[model samples]
Target: MIRSYRLLSLLVLALFALEPLQAQLMNKGTIKFEVTDVQTNNPDMQQMIGSMKGMAQTLQFDGAQQQMTVDMMGGLMRINTFWTGANSTVETYMDMMGQKIKTIMSNEDVEKMRKESEAMIKSEDIKYDKSVTKKILGKDCYKAYYETDANGQKFSMEMYVTEDIKVPNSFLQNLNQIELKGTPLMWIMDAGMMKMTFMATDISKDLGSDFFKKPEGAYQEMSMEQLKQMGMGGQIGF
Candidate 1:
């Protein structure tokens, strides 16, 4: 009886310890963000890219999987991108007008795409300064500065990332080949033609059960090459 009681007490204590760890885990949640500003160096494109401001983007993650959603045209068009760290695969689904298209990228495909993007970046090194910190959504975020060289033209950019929220990888960073750590809360990029800024607005742990559900209805799945061949290469985010 005494041995069993001791074992039960240890088990209870272990459970109590796990509660704190679980509370600290911000893995399963959504970080809501809005495109605060879009500046264009070109006077002609100012009216065009300016419309991009006030757009919404959400980052949802659970375990090793993260999904990003971009809503445009008041939901007339939507882009859903999923990254599975377990297999290093990326899947993108686009719903625009009446078209339902999807693209699945394997680990090799993602690596190839990342390499192509990394080539545009002159250096693979990133400078993350922990001393420069700020709070976003009440979470502390550190500063990271990096530059990219595209066709001999260089553009400087920086990101604010917080370790308080854990994610397998940052999707925007993956796409642009920015090697910043933790979850990015603020991203300021200068694309030469335009300067776009994205900042997190809300953080929530209430993703609910339908968070992982894929879009309903038929989706024509195609490879990356097929998508490019369709004259939609630059339109979609790989």
Candidate 2:
């Protein structure tokens, strides 16, 4: 009887050990941001900050599927991201404003981008070691500096990450209509600004597959230059 009891206890312990792993597998969350211009404070400039539907922006992560979807400008940017121990892969896509562009990269691609961006850093070397003080969402934030060299020009980059907020299921919760505070992923280039910020409203997780599908019917496929001539270049993916 003691041996049987020990076996049962072992089974229970095994189940307990697997619980955390299971939770990690199912971990998912959504992050939303309210976009505003720190310099101009003009609400209209906020629209030009990046592609977003009004002032609302959102990003959703599904840990189990290793996928994330960023919703902006009434369009979905799906990214297939997988992290293994320390390595990762991210595939980005945009289907909005009558345009579609997909970029897929593995850990190697990340390293390549890092190397290419080294020249843009203020240090002259590939190393980045500068931090800026800022306030986000009423909380203090440390903004890291980086640089990217594109088209023979160097551009400064700033990013912010926080450790204060922790939610078990951020995606499943109601996030919309909440004034969240956080610095978003932003990249400003010569052509325009590229940013990813959270929305102030929570959307139903029941987003249909069609939300990511491209629109049918006849549509004009214009080159970037052509779109610029037609004054629709910025409206499409930038």
Report clash pairs, candidate 1: none
Report the Cα lDDT for residue 62, model 2: 41
Off by over 4 Å in 2: 1-28, 38-56, 61-68, 76-87, 122-161, 165-238
lDDT of 1 by residue, 8-88 (tens): 222111110000011134888888888898887787665556446776778787776777777755775567777777787
Best by lDDT: 1
What 10-residue stretch in candidate 1 is worst by lDDT?
A: 13-22
**TM-score of model 2 (CA atoms):** 0.39
lDDT of 1 at 81: 75
Q: What residue runs in model 1 are displaced by over 4 Å at the alpha carbon?
A: 1-25, 117-124, 173-179, 230-238
lDDT (10s digit) by residue, model 2, range 106-202: 6665455345433333233222222665455443445544445658644443444233432222121111111223323331212233333332334
The predictions' CA RMSDs to the true structure, in order, are 15.4, 18.2
TM-score against truth, every candidate: 0.79, 0.39
lDDT of each: 0.64, 0.33
